[model samples]
Target: MILIINCGSSSLKYQLYTPDLAQVVASGMIAKIGEPEGYIDHFVGHRGEHHRCPVPNHRAAFALMMEYLQSPEYHVIECPRAITAIGHRAVHGGSVFFGSVLVDDAVMKALHECASYAPLHNPCNIIGIEEAQRMFPGTPNVVVFDTAFHQTIPARAHMYALPYELTQEHGIRRYGFHGTSCRYVSQRAADLLNRPIESLSMVVCHLGNGVTMDAVKGGQSIDTSIGFGTFGGVPMGTRAGDFDPAIIFHLVKDRGMSLEEVEEICYKKSGLLGLSGLSNDMREVSEAAAKGNARCQLAVDVFVYHIRKTIGAYAAAMGGLDALVFTAGIGENSAEIRAKVCEGLGFLGVEIDPRANEIARKGHPNISAISARAATLVVPTDEEKMIAIDTVQLTMAQPGAASVQMGHAPSTHGVAAS
Candidate 1:
């Protein structure tokens, strides 16, 4: 099995996958670390259990989780050593790693250097890697970056309209997030459309709590929405997506708010929660909008308007759109939101069939009319499977791989998911 780990500043999320990368062995998440009592939810096959765990840090959480992995009652692996490889979901690989790589002394150093780009995410990821290496000893470990997929975005699209020297010196350019999900969905979209991914022009809308629109050309990312940080692009759960530098200055000078305070506003107090004067959850906002709540309606309106504007702009940028994809939380569940965004896009040959969209949930495919020129699809992302595929391929390419393969059964082995 190749274990997949995605750690945040205070949470560690993990999945244990059979080496074939086709089926999950187990999955769980631990949250509120560094406290006397945290929470851990573990699932093996179809059964799961939740517990209030006193997880002190990533290391403590790892130790506790390893116990469960070794337990007979719900064990996925007979022993911890049964895990041949560990794949870490590292954010901000910067320009150093274009693809997933085996973690080593040099690679660990590079991950640290890129930490400033994603301070909130990378530190926890690094901690997890260190702990896993110590706990798993000689098992092969790899890092798959969230920023790595967007590395295909060319200079003109990623460059900022600032002094060239300052930009080069500071590495201040667009480095989009949700790349893992974006990459997976674009490939899935191609499959649904029955076309070569390399022969298609498509746009992927990853509209979760954190939203980003990526324009993929010829199976590569040509452009994406989130820039430099997750703090920009389309409005999200709590982030102020698009911001002006002058607004920060004004908030500091006129409102007497500190830069840090302003940053908090940009990060936590804005978006749907701030605009609607309600919760950040889209379901809540949608419910209030249905009840004729004006601010709630405006919040939904702003979101739909951004999607429409982004789709139109990306189509122009990519020459034309052959397919449009919607994935993640809001995109997958909200048929109402999808209809509103696809409206008036008939100019782009996007004709949404209301009935089809309404019944489209739980991983439904096309939601557009059969006569529509552009194909519209809703694909659930499988990031862990992608990570497992990359891990197996990279590890198998190394020396002694045959011996490594012989150590595990066929069920523990996986086909490389390229």
Candidate 2:
């Protein structure tokens, strides 16, 4: 079995895929970890069920997941040994790892060095890796980085126009996040368009609580929004994106606030929630705007405007775009958001069928429309699946059979353990 594990700051999501990968034999999530009321949501049956049990820490939560997977009630596998490999979704690999690798002492050390780039993500990711190593000793494990997919970006694009010394010394470059999602969605879009991925130039919009726009030219990343840290780029749930450094200077020097306080404001007290003075939920913001909430209206407009403007910029960068791909929560689910984003994008020769956009609500293959020049698609993000596939391929002991095994793993033939 191939087990995929995504460890967030306060949650752990796990899924068990049989060697053939036809169905998710077992899947569950442990949310609110480290809190007293935190619980486990265990799912087993074809449709599965939600069971809530106190989960105090990641280790405890993982142990609980193991128990549930082995239990007759869940019956994911006869024993823990049935799980041959573990795939972990590690957020930042910095500039070191251009692809996935088996988690070794060296890899762990490199992850620690890159933790400064993703403060909220890397530490937790490392914790999960260490704990999983403890929980399933001798089990093959791999780390699939979110930044790996975008490593194809050329230096001219990924490098900022900062001092050369600063760039070289601090690793200050645009190592984009959400690369797994971008990779998955873009590949799916290529398949939907019935075009070879290498021949396509596309713009992928990944909008969730966190948002990013990437310009992919001929199957390689040319540019992306987020910079060295998650705090830059377009505004998100609580993050103040792409603000001037002068703002921080004013807050610290003029307002007599500490540097940390200023950072807290930028990272937590801005964005949609701050601008609207309400919830960060886009659906809620849309409703409020419709009800004549001025600030809320401003927030929605700014969000969509940012997306549209960025799309235009990416189109320019790519010289031309063959497809516009949307993924993640809001991009995949909200018809209104998608429509508003494409409103002024006609200059790029892109149009969406309103009816198709609305109906392509969930699941993959949500191709909303196609114009003479460009196609628009709403592909549900599958970062976990991408991570799992990468993990299985990179960590598989047998080299020649890896790709073939992965491509057909969802069928009856199981992965032949090397």
Best by TM-score: 1
lDDT of each: 0.84, 0.80
**Per-residue lDDT of model 2, residues 1-418, tens digit only:** 9999999999999988877666777788889898778877777765565666677888888888888888876556887778899999989887677777787777787789888888889999999899889988899788888887776666677776777556556666778889989988888888888889999889999998899899887777778999778877888878888878888888888999999898787788888898999977888988999999999999998898888888998999888978898889898888899889988777777888888888886453445455536888888888878877877777656753322311112111111210
lDDT of 1 by residue, 104-187 (tens): 777888788889888888888899899889989999888888887887777778877788654556767788988888888999
What is the lDDT for 131 in model 1? 87
Candidates' TM-scores? 0.94, 0.92
Q: How close is candidate 2 to the true structure, as a TM-score?
A: 0.92
Off by over 4 Å in 2: 362-372, 397-418
